[model samples]
Target: MFHVGFVCAEYRRRDGDGDDELVGGSGLSRSPSRSRMIKRLESLNTVISSIWWVFGFYWIVVGGQPLLQDAPRLYWLTVVFLAFDVFFVIFCIGMAFVVFLALFCCIPILAIAYAVASTEGASEDTIRSLPKYRYRPATVLSTFNNLGMEEVLGARSGLGNNGSSGELFLHSEDSECCICLSSYVDGAELYTLPCNHHFHCSCISKWLLINATCPLCKFNILKGDTLV
Candidate 1:
């Protein structure tokens, strides 16, 4: 807070083009990482303000004080001017703080709000109105309960992650649920959508609710569709 005013004051003197170029190309406005962008800007502003504030003090001490020993008339005049300069600096610092805070702090927020708000297809109502399903695949034991030892062993073999080392008893185009990026397992609950796409129960539910579309085919689930 000590040098906040000074830093803000110095900002008025800085080149707008450099910052504009950096911000314009940064893609922060189109990103969900907008919060991170703001944090970085605040940190960078503090560092820059410190540098400018320290240099200002250094210049005043090293440059201004050296000129006071010439003569009485000049000495008094210098003293009066220095006093006025100090007051002027203080006033400028206050005004500059308000201007900079208003200008710099609000730019990102407003830019990002407009950038994202202009987009479509996502809303609280869409998410809240989404359907959910709790799918349950048959248990392996039930399928193999009355089977022979060889059949039971083969069923156990297909449970391998890639089915690379096993007999691959359970194999299909839907072997893996893309929404969760995971392979289906026996008794794993899932949602089979109206588009005939299936995903882990929680995975597709969350995804569909967020975008209201099938993660695979982009089927609009909110438009008279439901979980199968």
Candidate 2:
């Protein structure tokens, strides 16, 4: 009978599963058995372990991660912006360096050119080179004939020994060739610049081959002449 009573009490505890409702008498709850309590604690730990993880045994503070594969949206956005900022800063620095290098290289060369132009004169200065053109009939010819006029300056001046033509021919003949300091021989071919400045065919031809500017007015011959 004593063994039977002990078996009955043990059976009641097993049925309880450490739950309050199974406790006998007056319906009051009882503290669970130590073994039951331990099992319950272990089950709770198992569920938590699946959701949260701790890593790094050697570190002072272990890092606990809630999710391994998926990060927070805000966190990844922050990382992307930080990466872009780094590239932008590097590009700005490179551009600034290029600008500084350009200025440093150009200033002295410009200063030297200015000095040469001032001291030696426009003709002697080589740095700002005048664009030289091969003499073509279009650029060096006069407006007196079709070779010169080509309909552009036909009304302004005419062919003949009268009016503007007379004065111009007379003046051109009396004046010396500015480039070579030579006299114009009668019936010799003369090339006239758009500036209406005339020179010997040989002198002006060679001059155009060397420099495209009119020797008297410094007008660029390649640019259409501003007939005076």
Candidate 3:
């Protein structure tokens, strides 16, 4: 009776195998997950490329319309402007590509660095021992005060001449103080730095008391001075 039962079980197993094959064997039953992902990526790339092409086409069609008209001056102006726009777009795209490439290349380098740091058992003392790249706030503040003191004294000496501040002068109408974001008024007290940059006397004095460099160009005022 046991032998007969075993034979029946074997027959059932064979019947199940035939049904599995008919439904599609185990090897071919699973979905193509990787192929679906590739399709998705391809579709995304196609959509982006299509949008870029459309934008370029529209720009060319609309931008050249002025050139096709009879106004010669307008045509030349439009041409120049379009040329600059194209150049700017190309430059931005190139910069973005370079940034993307750098990021892609840095991933593996960062992973390796982290792995090495972990394996070597990095400590706080070792990190602190590494060469620092930042400047101390105290040093920056001292330099600012030192540079501002000389200008402040000069402005005071010039103040006695007919109430006109000698350290300040009226600059061009278009000139603006970068620190205060104010346009230069006629006869307003202005301070001109050694770098030929001008600013409001009050605004620059306060700024120099905190930073020794030119606010706009960042030229160091005390770079050349030394203890003789």
Cα lDDT, all candidates: 0.56, 0.51, 0.56
Q: TM-score per candidate, in order? A: 0.28, 0.29, 0.26
| Candidate 1 lDDT by residue in tens digits, 71-97 | 657656655766786799999999999
**How does residue 4 of candidate 2 score in lDDT?**
51
Judge candidate 1 at residue 142 and give its lDDT: 39
Clash list (residue pairs), candidate 3? none
How large is the C-alpha RMSD of every model relative to the true structure?
Answer: 18.5, 27.5, 27.7
lDDT of 1: 0.56
For 1-228, candidate 3 gives per-residue lDDT tens digits of: 333554565566556667778987653333345345545666676687668656765765686665456566866765576678779899999999988987888877897787544333223332222221111122333336756756654554455333444433222443677898877655565655667576666676666655556766766555522211
Better of 1 and 2 by lDDT: 1
Ordered list by TM-score, greatest first: 2, 1, 3
